[model samples]
Target: MVAREQFQVELSKLRGDIISLAHETEKLLEKSLEALYNQDIDMANDIISYDTKLDQKELKINEDAILLIARQQPVATDLRRLIIALRISSDLERMGDNAKNIAKSTIHLGEEHGLTIHPALTDMKNIALKMVDLSIKAFEYEDITLARKLSELDDLVDSMYGEIIREMLEETATNPQKIQHIMQMAFSARYIERFADHTTNIGESILYLVKGETLNLNE
Candidate 1:
């Protein structure tokens, strides 16, 4: 009984640590997107630099979770929870990495041409940020309803991405010099789309926490 209680405490600790990592990664992504929107290369650079800190936190969380699993050999449900937490941590870390990649692209684009960003793309960017924010909120609060709504918001970002892609393709045809610049902008937009996807993944993770079933919003 005493050993079981000890294992429970370790599991709780691991869960808290995982949530912390998730929150930090979300912050990194938020700053990265803001840097892109505002054309703050310095802010983007800071976000890129901090991504390594998140990587370290993820490594530590992985080690701690693994150590607990080996030490406790948690039973079926507990094992599942731990595994899900590990997967969520991995996903969050990768999201941070993606944000860093987008920041680099933002810097490149900003340097090449003073961005003549369309208002429509700005709306798309805002929606992407909103989805990510709400997804994190849903996870922290375990609000399945909020998670469901994020799926709808993500669709808005998807539509914006499609519009921008088509516009860029047409622009490239008319003025070939703009191709490389627009392509980088398109890539930045693509990263945001993927970021929203990751946000939905977080929502799915929260759903799994509540229902013990996997929900893949992307599918």
Candidate 2:
């Protein structure tokens, strides 16, 4: 009984750690997007530098969770929960990496040509950020229904991405000299779209937590 209680305590801590990582990644992504919007070179640089913190947090969570598994030898649901926690941490870390890439693109798009961004990017970013928020909320509650909503949100982002690419390519044809800026904007959009996919993956993980069945919402 004592061992079981101790294992539960460790499992609770692991869950808390994973939630904290998601929140941290959310903040990083928000700041990076703001930096991109405002074209703040210093802020973009800071976002790039801050990625190491997310990396370290992910590593610590995995290490602690693995130690618990080794000591407790958890089976069935307990083991699955710990395993899902590890997957969530990995998705969150990759989300952080995507944010870092967006920040880099923001830096690359320094105010050289008096750039005016596409309206589609605004729509795309909004949906992507919403996915991040909703996915984390779903995970916290283990709400399978809420997790399923992510697929629709992911679809919205994907649609906007296609529109952005089409518009940018057309604009590039006219302003051939600004091809480099166009590429950076396109890459930034791709990064955000990719992050949204990762967020959906998190929602899928949370759904697995609730239903004990894995569903690939990405498809």
List lDDT for all candidates, in order.
0.77, 0.86
Cα lDDT of model 2 by residue, 93-136, tens digit: 99999899989988889956577866677677778878888987
Mind giving the per-residue lDDT tens digits that candidate 1 earns over 15-128?
Answer: 788777777776776777677778889998998899999989888888888888888888666776677677778877888887898789778877547557545656765677
Top TM-score hit: 2
Q: Per-residue lDDT for 217 in model 2?
A: 92
Supply candidate 1's per-residue lDDT for 27. Answer: 75
The ten-residue window of minimal lDDT in model 2 covers 111-120
Clash statistics: count for each candidate: 0, 0
